[model samples]
Target: MAETGAPRRQSLGFLLLYALAWAGGAMAYVPFLTILLPARMTALVGVSDVEYLGYVTFCGAVAASLAGIAFGWLSDVTRNRRGWIAAGLVLTILLLLAVPLAKDVWTLIGIILLWQLALNMVLSPLAAWAGDCVPDEQKGLLGGLIALSPALGAWSGAIATTPGLVSVDGRLAVVAGLVLLAVTPVLLFGRPRPFPELTAPPPVCADGDVAARPRGPAVRMWLARLLVQIAEAALFAYLYFWFRSIDPAMQDNEKARLFSVALTLAVPVALLAGRWADRRDRPFLPLVIGASVSAMGLVGMALAGDAGMAKASYLIFGIATTVFLSLHSGQTLRILPRSDRRGRDLGVFNLTNTVPSLIMPWLTISLVPGFGFETLFLLLAALAAGAVLLLATLPRGR
Candidate 1:
C-alpha cells in the first residue's frame, strides 16, 4: 500500500474548521448516550433501568466494535473518508429521527444497536482522517481544539432537554438539525489535499525489523487510553443519573448546563496543556497529570456527603478527563507505525473506546445497586490511577 506521506501543517483556520466539524459530529450522538438514552431507558424499563442499561450498552458496544473495524477497513480500502463520513452521518440522522417510534424496551434496544453501528461508521473514519491528515507537530493543539467538542456536545444536550422540546421526536429533530449545521462547513471545505508523492514502508525481514519497533508505544498508548476511557465511560454514560441521584430536585436541563460548564472550563486548561506538551515535547506528562488529577476528583466525589460537594467533585473530574482525553487523542496520531493503514489501526485502537462501554454498565450494575455510586466512583478512581501508571512507561518523544 502506498502512503500519503507526511501531511503538511494546516493553517489555523483549516484546523478550526476541521475541529468544528468534528464537534458537530460529536454533538449528533453524544447527548443521546449521555442524557437521552438513559432517560428513555428509565421511561421504558422503569425499575429495570440498571439491567436494561447494561443490556443496551452491551449490545451497542458489540455493534460499535464490529462496525468500527469493518467501516474503518472499508475506508482504508476505498480511500474515501469524506464519502464514508457523509454516509454515516446521513444514516445516523435517519435512525435518530426514528428513535421515538420505539414502543418497547426490545424495540428501543434494536434501534440503539443500529444507531451505534451508524454512529461509528462516521466516527471511525472521521478519526482516521485526523491520523491521515494532521501532522505530529500540531497534534497537541488539535487535541486542545478537540476538547471543545464535549463542551459543545453537552450544550447541545442541554438544548435537547429544554422545556420547549416536549416530545422525544421533537428533541431528536432539533439535535439532528444542529448536527447538519455543524457538519456543513467540513463538507464544504474538507476536501483531501493531493499527496503529490506516495511513500513506501521500510523493508522488513522475516522476523520483522528489530531496529525500529512501533508496536510497543502504540499498544501502550492504547492501554493508557483504555484505563482512562473506562473511568470516563463510568462517569459519562451515567452522569445524568448520578447528578439526579445526588439532587432529585435538579432539572434535566440544569444537569446538562452544569455538565457543559465543567467541560467548557476545561477547554482553556486543555488547550494550555496541549500547547505546553507540544512546546516541551513532553506529551506523556500531560496524560499522566490528567489521569492523576481526575483520580483525585473521583476520590472527592466518592467521599462527598452533599449535592454541592458532589457537583464540585464532578467539575474537577470533568476538567481532568477532558484534558486527558483530548491530549490522548492528539498523541495517538504521533505514534502510528504506518500512515497507509491509519484507518484500520485507528479502528483497532478505538476498541479502547468501545470496550469500555461494554464493561461500564456491568460495572455500574454490579457495584451501584449492591453498594452505591461511591463504590463505583472509587473503583473508577483506582482505574484512573492505573492509567497514570501505565502512561508513565511510554518512551519520551513517542
Candidate 2:
C-alpha cells in the first residue's frame, strides 16, 4: 500500500456548513431527553419517574449502539457513506414528527428506539467521515469542528426547551425541519472529493515502513481516548439530574443557562486544545493532563453544596472536558489502522462512546440510591484518572 500524503486544508465555508448541519441533526436527542420526553411522559402518561426514564434511555442507547455498528458496517461495504447519512436524517425527521402522537410509555419508547437507530446511522458515519476527508495536519481544525458539536447541540436543545416559546411537539417539529433544511444543502453541494493523491503511499519495509499502520504509541493514544470518552459519557448521562438534585427549585431556563455556560467554556477551550495538538505535536501529555484536571473538576462537583460553587465546578468540568476531547480528536487520525477503513474503524471506536450509556443506567441505579450522586462523581473521577494513566503509557513518536 502506498502512503497517502497529508490532506489539504478544507475551506472554512465547508467546515461551517458541516458544523451547522451536524448541530441541527445532533440537537434532536439532547432536548428530547433533557426536556421533551420527560415533560411529555409526565403530562400524558403520569410517568414522570426518574428511574423509568433512566431505563428507557438505557434501551435507546443499546438500540443506538447496535444500529450504529450495523449501519456503519453496511456503509463501508456499500461505499455510500453519505447515502446512509441522508437516509438517517430523513428517518429521524419523520420519527420526530411521529413522537407527538404517542399516548403511552411503550409507544413513546418504541418511537424513541426507531429515532435513535436512525440518528446513530447518521452520527457514526459522520464521525468517521471527518477522518476520511480531512488530512492529519488539518485534524486540529477538524477536531475543533467535532468538539463544537456538543456545545452546538446543547444550544439548540436549550432553544427548543425555552418556556412557552414552543410547545414540546412544536419544538420537535421545528428541530426536525431545521435539521433537514440545514443538512440538505451540505449533502447536495459540499461533496468532498476523495483525495486519491493522499491515499497512495510509498512501499513499506518489513519492520517500520508500513504506510497506514499506526505505531505502538498511536494505538495507546486511541485506547486512552476510549477510556476518557466512557468517563465523559457516564457523567453526561446524569448531569441534568445531578443539577436538579443539588437545587430542587432550579428552573428549566436556569438549568439550560448553566449547561450553556459549561458548553461555552468548553467550546473555545476545545478549539485551543486542538490547535495546540496540531502545532505542538503533544498528544499524550495533553490528554493525560486534561483528564487529570477534569477529574479534579468532577471531584469539585461531587463535593459542592452551594449554587455558586456548583457553577464554578461546572466551569472547570467544561474546560477540562473541552481540552481532553479536542486533543483526543486531533490525535485519532494519527492512530487509525488504515485510511480506507476509517469509517469502519471509527464505527468500532464509537462503540466505546455508546457502551458507556448502556452501563450508566445500571451504574446509576446501583449507586445513586445508596451512595448518591456524589459517589457517582467520585467514580467518574476514578475513570478519568484511569484514562490519564492509560494515556501516559503511550510511546512518544511522530
Candidate 3:
C-alpha cells in the first residue's frame, strides 16, 4: 500500500457532514446504552433493575460485536458503504422507537439486542466509509472534527435526563430526532473523494524488520488502543465512585458536570493537536503523547488527597483519553489490514472498545474493592504506559 498519486481532498462540506453523521451514530448509542436503558429497566423492575440491565448490556455487547463484524464484512464485499449506512440509520431509528414500546424486561432486552445490531449497521459501515473517502492528508483534522461525537453524545444524555423537560417516551423521540438531524444531511449531501491507497504503506518496525510491521502497524495500534481502552472503561465505570470515595458529600450532577466539561475541552484541544499532526505528517504522535499524559493523570489520581486535586486529575485523564480515542479513530483507518476488507477489519479492531467493558469489571472487582482506587490507578497508569511503548515502536509515517 504505497503512496501513489497526489492526495485527493474533499470539500469542507463533506467533511463536516461526515463528522456530524459519525457523531450522530454516537448520539444513537451513548444515551440509550448509558442512560435510557438503565432508566427504563429501573422503571420496570424498581429495585431489582440491575439484574435485568446487566442481562441487556451483556447480550447487547455480544450482539454489537457480531453485527459490527458481519455487516462490516458485507459492506466490504459489496463495496457499498452509503447504502448500508442509510439502511442502518432507518433501522436504528425504528429500534429507538421500539425501545419504549417493550412491556417486559426480556422484551426490552430483545429490543436492545436488535438495536445493537442496527446501530452497528450504521457505525461499522460509517467507519469504513471514512476509509473509503477521506485522504490521509486530512485524516488528522477529521480525527479532530469527529472528536465531537462523545461530547455530543454526553450532551444528548444531559438533555434526555433533564428533570421535567420531557416525558420518557419523548426523550427517546428526541434522541431519534437528533439522530435524524445529524445523519440525514450527510447521506443526502456528502460527496467524499476516495483516497487512492486504501491501506497505508507498511511501516518499518522498531527493530528494522519490515516483516514485523503486521500489515502497516495495525496490530500495534490496535493493541495500544486496547490497553488505553481498558483503562478508559475502568475509569468510565468507577470515576464517580472514586470521586465519592474522596468526598461523600458530592452530588451526581456535580460529577456529571465535571465529565461534561472535560469532554468539551477535548474538542478544541484535539483540534489543535490533530491539525498539528496533519501539518507535520506525524499522525500517531498525539496518541503516544496523550497516552503518556493519561498515565501521569492516573498517577495524580492515585496520590491526590482531596476532592479538588481528584477532580482536576480526573479532568486531565478524561481529556487526554478522550482525545487519544478520537484521534485514533481516524488514524486507525490509515493502517487497516487491507483496503478491500477495511470494514471487516475495522470490526475486528472494534474489539478494543467492547472487550474492555468485559475485562474492566473483572479487573476492578479484583483490585479496587480490596486494595482501593490508588492501586487501581497505578495499574491503569502502567497500562497507559504500555500503550506509549507500543506506539513508540511503530514507524513514524509521513
Candidate 4:
C-alpha cells in the first residue's frame, strides 16, 4: 500500500464536523421504522392489509447497498469524494421531503428507494474519507464517532416525531428540511484543505499481487459482526411494535422516551469500549463479551412479557450491543484489504449490515407472525450466540 504520512490525530473540530454530517445523514436512515412509517402512515397508504411496507423496506436496503458500492467506486475513480457527498446530501433532502406526499404504496416505495440510494451515495464516500485521512492509530476514535451516528439519529428522530410537533408527514418533511439546512454550511463552508492526489496505484504484496483477496481472519470476523448486526436489526426494527404488543396502552411519547434512554446508555458504553480496545489491544474480547451479553439481554426481553421487564431488557441490550458494535467496527478497519479503497471495501462490508435488514422483514412479517415475537427473540439470541462462536474462531492480533 502506498503509505501516507503518519496519520495526524484529527482535531476535535474535524471530528465534530464529521459527526454532525453523519447525524444529518442518519436522519435519512435510523428513523424509518420509529418515526417515518409508523402505523398511521401505513394505514394512510391503504397497503396496511398486505405486508407491502416490508417489501418496500427490503427494496430500499437493496438499493442502498447497490448505490453504496457504486458511489464508493465512483468516488475512488473520480478522486472527488466531497462532490459526491454534497450531491447525496442535496438529493436525500429533496427525496425525504417528497416521501410524505406519496399517495400510494408504489410511490412511497419509489421515493424510499431513491432516498436510500442518495443516502448511501453520501455515506459510502464519507466512510472512505475517514480511512483516507485517518491512520490506523486513530481507528478507535473514528469508530467511536461512527458509533455515535446511530444514537444521534435516533435522538433527533424522536424529537421530530414527538406528538403535536408536526403531523407524521409534516415531521418527515421537517426532518428532511433540517438535514438539508444543516448540511449546507458544512458542505459549502467547512471545506477540507485538498491533499495531493495519489498518482500511483496502491502497492501490492511482496510477491507483486494486485488482486484484492479477503483476509481469512478478517472474513471470519466480518461474519461474526454480520451475525451480531442481524440480531440488532431484528430487535431495533421491531422494538416499537414489540412495545405496543406488550403494552397496548403505551403512548408514542413513552415509547420514544424508552428508545431514547436505551440509545443514551448505548452511546457512552460504545465510546468507552472503543477507547478500551485501543489502549489494551483487545478488540476481539469486547466483541465476544458483548455478543454473549446481548444474547442474554434478548432472552431477558423474551421472558419479560410486561413493561418493566422489557425496559430492563432494553437497557441490557443497548449496553451490550453498543460495546460489540464499537469493537467490531474498530477491528473491521484493521482487517480491510486496501487502505486506499476503504470506502469500497467498507461499503461491501456494510452489506453484512444492510442485507440483514433486507431479510429481516421476511423474518418479522412471515416467520414472527407464525411463530410469535417470543420465538423470534429466541432466534435472535441464538444468532448472537452464533456470533460469539464465530468470533472465538478468529485469530487475535493487535
Candidate 5:
C-alpha cells in the first residue's frame, strides 16, 4: 500500500475524547467478562472452576471469532463502520442487561456466548475504524491513548464488584450507563472521518508472485501478536481464580484494584513509548523491547511461591503486557499490506485476539489441574519468547 502524504495532525482534544469513548466502551463489559462471569460460572456449575471456565471461554471465543470476521467484512462492504458500532453497542448493552436472568449454568453460558458475539461486533469495527481514519504518523499517539482502555476496564471492574454492588443487575446497569457515556463523545462531537471512496480493486497476487515479499513482515507481525495475546489471555481469564487460590482472604475488589494499579502504571509508559516511536519513526523497536520484558515477567510469575510474590509478578507482567499490546496495536496499522481491505484484513488479524482466548482455556485445563499454574506460566513464557523471536525477524524501519 502506498503511504499517503503528511496528513493533518488531529487535535489533542479530539484524540483525548476519542480515547475516552474507546475506554468507556471497554469499561462497560470487560469487568463482566473478566470478573463477574467467572464467579457466576463457578456458582452455577457443579464442576471445578478451571473446567467450567474452559468450556465457557471456548464457546464464547468461537462466537467472538466468527462475529468479528463477519461484522468486519460487512463494514468493509457497506462502508458503514459507525452504523455497525452503534448497533453492536446497543445489542451488547441489551444482552448485558439481561444477564441477570440467566438462572442456570447453561443459560449463563448461552448469554455469555451471545454477549461475546455482540461485543465483537462493536470491537472489530471500532478497530478497523481507527485504521481507516487515523493517519500513519499519528498511530503511535493513538496507541498511547488506547492504553487507557485496560486501566478504565479494570477500574470499572472494581466498581462493579464492590460490596453491595456485586449483584448482576446492579453491575449491568452501571456498566451499560458507562458504555453509553463513553461512546457519546465520538458519536456526538467527534465523528470519524469517512473512508476514501473505493476505486479500482487491487489485483490479488498468485502464489510465486514477487508481490508477496511485502507480506512477510506482516505475517511475522501477526504471529508475534498471536503469541503475546496467548500469554495475555492466559493471565486475564484466570487471574481472579489464581489470586483467590493463593490467598483465600483476598477480595475481588482488591484484585481489581491491583489490576487497575498495574494498568495505570503502564499508561505513562505507553505514552512515552508511543511518543518515542513517533519522534524516531521506529515503532518496531518498542515492540521488541516490550516483548522481551514480558517474557521476564512471565518467568518471574513461574518462580513465585506465595501470594505476595505472585502479586509482584503479576504487576510486572501486567505493566509489560499493556505496553507490548498498545504498541503492537498501533504498529499494526502501519504494517498492514492492503489498504483497500483494511477491515477484512484486520478481522483476520483479530483471530490472534479471539483465537488466544479459545486456546488459553484448553491450555489452562490441560496444564493447571495436572501440572499446576507454575507449569502454565512457564509455557506462557515460552510463547512470549516465541513472540520476541518472531518480532526480531522484521527489518529495520518497519
Candidate 6:
C-alpha cells in the first residue's frame, strides 16, 4: 500500500484510548459466547446443550465474518470510522439486552447472529482506525496494549458469572453496561483522525517514508496466522477434556483458572515482545519466535503423561499463542495493501480467527476421539510449526 506520506505519530493517550476501544470490542462478545450463552444453552437444552451451543456459535461466527467485511467496506465507502463504531456499539448493546427475551434455542441463535453482526460493526472500523492513527513505529506497542482486550474480556466474564452477583438477565445487562462504559469514552472525547476517502494514497510508515509492504507478505502473514490459530482453537476447545484424560480428578474450574492465568500472563508477555519489536523494527521476528515456541509447547504437551506437566506445557502454548495473536493484529495493519481498503482487508484477515473455529471441531473429532489427545497435540504442533515456516519465509523487513 502507498501511504499519503510518513505516518502521523499519535500520542500515548490516543494509543491507550485506541487499545481500550479494541478491548471493548472484544468485551462485547467474549463473555456472552463463553459464559452467558452456554448457561442459557444449559437452561434450554440440558442433555444436548453443547450441541445447540455449537450451532449457535457456528452461526454467530458466520454472521460476524460477513458483518465484519460489510461494515468495514461501508466505513471505507463512507469514510466515517467513529460513526460506524458508535452505531455498532449501540446495536450491540441493544442485541445484548434482547438476549434475555429468547427462551428457545433457535431464538437465541437468531439474537446471537444479530449480536455478532453488530459487534463486528464496532470492531472492523475500530481496527481500521488504528491504521489511520497509529504510526508503524508504535504499532508493536499498540499490539502490546491491545493484548489487554482478552484479559479484560476474561475479567468481565468472571464478573458476569460471579456467584450470587446477578441473574441471567442481570448478567446480560452488566455486560452491556460494561461495554457502554468502556466504549463511550473513545466515541465522545477521543480525537482519532477521521477515516480518509477511498482514493487515499497508500499508508505511510513511521520513518518518514511510504510503506513498501506488498500483498505477498500480507498473504503469507495471513496464512501463518491461520495455522497458529488452528492450534490455539484446538487447545481452547479440548483443554478440559485433555486434562481430564491426564487426571480424572481435575475439575473444570481448574482448567478455567489455567485459562485465566494463560491469558493474563500473556498480556505482559505481549507488551514486552511488542515493545522489543518496535525498538528493533522487526515485526515478523516476534511472530516467528512465538510460533516456534508454541510448536515446542505443543510437542511438550503431546509427551506429557502427568497433569502437572500438561498444565505447564499448555501454559507455554497459551501464552505464546495469545502474544502472537495480539502482535499480529497490530502488525497486520502495517502490511495491509492500501489505506483505503485497510478495514475491508482487516475483515478478510479476521477470517483467520473464525475459520479455525469451523476447522478445529472437525479436526478434533477426527483425531482426539480415535487416536487420543497425544495425536491431536502432535498435529497441532505441526500446524504451529507450519506457521513458523510460513512466517520464516516472509522477506526480512520491518
Best by TM-score: 1
Top-lDDT structure, candidate number: 1
lDDT of 6 by residue, 1-398 (tens): 23468554567777788778888876777677656776688788886765675577578778888988899889988889999999999999999999889988889889988888889999999988888877777888999998888777767777776667887579889888888888888888887554344246766778987764468988898999999988887775456456767998965345556777787899999999999998888888999999998999999999998888888998898888889999999888878887877789989998898788777777776776579889988998999998888887675556
lDDT digits (tens) for residues 1-398 of candidate 4: 22367544545566667767766776667676665665535566554633775677688889988988889888888877789999998888888778767887777788888888988888888777765655455567666666676676677777787888888678777677667764566566554433333223556778988755468876877788788888888776777678878898987767766776776677777777767766766667767888999999999988997889988997898778866775576667667776567677878887987888888888888767787788888888999999999887665555
Error of 6 at 396 (Å): 2.8
The residue pairs in collision within model 3 are: none
Per-residue lDDT of 49 in model 3: 63
Q: Report every candidate's CA lDDT.
A: 0.84, 0.73, 0.83, 0.74, 0.82, 0.81
The TM-scores of all predictions, comma-separated, are: 0.93, 0.89, 0.87, 0.90, 0.92, 0.88
Question: lDDT for model 1, on a 0 to 1 scale?
Answer: 0.84
Per-residue lDDT tens digits of candidate 3, residues 325-363?
999998998877567778999999998887776677667
Of the candidates numbered 4 and 5, which has the greater TM-score value?
A: 5
Q: RMSD in angstroms, all models? A: 3.2, 3.5, 4.6, 3.2, 3.1, 4.6
Please tell me which model should have the higher TM-score, number 1 or number 5: 1
**Candidate order by decreasing lDDT:** 1, 3, 5, 6, 4, 2
Task: After superposing candidate 1 on the true structure, give the runs of residues whose Cα lies further than 4 Å from its correct spot.
Answer: 1-8, 191-213
Candidate 4 clashes between residue pairs 3 or more apart in a chain or in different chains: none
Q: Between 1 and 2, whose lDDT is larger?
A: 1
Q: What is the lDDT of residue 118 in candidate 4?
A: 89
Q: Which ten residues in a row have the lowest lDDT in candidate 3?
A: 194-203
lDDT of 5 at 220: 92
- List where candidate 2 sits over 4 angstroms from the true fold: 1-7, 44-48, 197-223
Pairs that collide, model 6: 2-202, 2-203, 3-202, 3-203
Give the Cα error of residue 265 in candidate 3, in Å: 0.5
* After superposition, candidate 5 runs with Cα above 4 Å error: 1-7, 165-168, 192-213
Candidate 2 pairs with clashing backbones: 2-201, 3-200, 3-201, 3-202, 4-198
Q: What lDDT tens digits, residue by residue, belong to model 2 across residues 283-364?
A: 5566777898888998998899887788798778777876677557657766776666666666666666677778777888
Q: After superposition, how far is residue 159 of candidate 2 from its true place, in Å?
A: 1.0
Order candidates by TM-score, high to low.
1, 5, 4, 2, 6, 3
